[model samples]
Target: MHLDACTIYRYSSYFIRVFTHIYWKSAEPCLILQKNPTRPIALDLQDIHKSYGSLEVLKGVSLTAYDGDVISILGSSGSGKSTLLRCINLLENPNHGRILIGNEELMLKPAKSGELQAADVKQLESLRARVGFVFQNFNLWPHKTILQNIIEGPTQVLKIKKRPSDRCRKIARSRPTSKKKDAYPANLSGGQRQRVAIARALAMQPQVLLFDEPTSALDPELVNEVLAVMRELAEEGRTMLIVTHEMRFAREVSSKVVFLHQGVVEEIGTPEQVFDNPTSERVKDFMASHRPT
Candidate 1:
């Protein structure tokens, strides 16, 4: 059977839209509206621990981020900085811990393997949507246009209508990658792609943002573009947990700095305390090594 180009295009578009609608609808029960909590804590992790086989990655890590706080997680390689970040959203479930977002606690049940898993999958899904994660490597969908990528979560997961979703896409794009809405990810520069990724996360209107070394994969020259966006977010008082090696940026932008050593928090305090007058010998040595000549 011979089909015209228009006919094939129409069929493909219809199927894509229908599939998206149906898939999201199946998860609709898990999508609950968030209520305003009196508590100001945006995120709280208590006594979190993680291990891979015999190697423990995180050891009894606890941190709290009040609303609008920018907390920078710093450590050398294998200090579990990224692992601790991942555990907050359960990208990597911890062996033991408690996590609270706002006033709502993430219910967890122990598994046979002694790992903790989400007790209520629906609730977990609902809470996870409120946390936005930005990766070191830009995780954009190669086939989707930038606009499509930004609007997808709102339109599909949140079931937002076209008009409001369009507004969100515009707001998200306003700060980052405004010129490349029609371009695909492959067409943009590495910095542009990371900016687009940030825009996509912003479109969700998340309560908190987690950046796992967002600029680590970029070239030295391109790093500033992404950092500039993050700096603007900090200035706007966005609650963020950033795992980064950019010591100067952390010192300048973070409300608090946490230095992790050997899977434990070696030191945590204001940027001044951690960077200038750290009491921990390990942290002092680490700071000295990172200090600019």
Candidate 2:
């Protein structure tokens, strides 16, 4: 018996849905009801396009992230990988596109120059608060201690009062903590800083986490510590969108992979399809070039 690609995808998707329903129902009956048992989309980007003057960065890119999905975006530099991630959280206003978070459409207005702008500032902020972004440079405040940095977003944006001991428990408990929880960024190693950055994002209790080359700045020795934390998050079924050069991590962790080349989506599918049976020549070459010698 033979099955076409579409048929195979459909079957696989159905199996996943069934498995998820059973697992969640058994693990947390209350959450399954609150999250809508059938299907709940966490994030949606429709026909996203961004241009810098005459140079188009992302062209007609669309992505949908279902609850508990980890979609990894891969490409060489200048391939618009990071730009797509930025557009999702409105850090870069897409020239033309629509965004939705959990079935709620974000309001947008057309600018005189024909670019789309958020119609309401407050609405945009509220929408952004739901999506947590982790940048390549662990953008922690230099003067703030690790604990201070972690709680800052919750205090300001989420209006969460600090309950020092409880706060520590809410964020990742297993990650390495400083002997003095108040050590500044300068005092922490690269891995520790990035882990703190992840904890900061988690403190917001976001619907989704967006990671942009999260480990690129760290020394080779420190990358694994950060990756371990990410792996733990993935296991606990966090909805994530990671733009990374860590192909091995992507292959092992992602539910879906999107390959962008020169501002267009070159290939997208499950890890097996994208990595093992890529249909695009550009993706084939890109993977080949990245292979370790």
Candidate 2, position 156, lDDT: 75
Candidate 2 has a TM-score of 0.82
Per-model TM-score versus the true fold? 0.82, 0.82
Query: Candidate 2 lDDT, tens digit per residue, 1-81?
Result: 443222222333221221111121122111111223465899989999999999999899988888888888999899999
Which candidate ranks first by lDDT, i.e. highest? 1
Cα lDDT, model 1, residue 288: 95
Model 1: worst 10 consecutive residues (lDDT sum) = 24-33
Clashing pairs in 1: none
Write down the lDDT of every candidate, Cα atoms only: 0.77, 0.75
* Consecutive 10-residue window with the lowest summed lDDT within model 2: 24-33
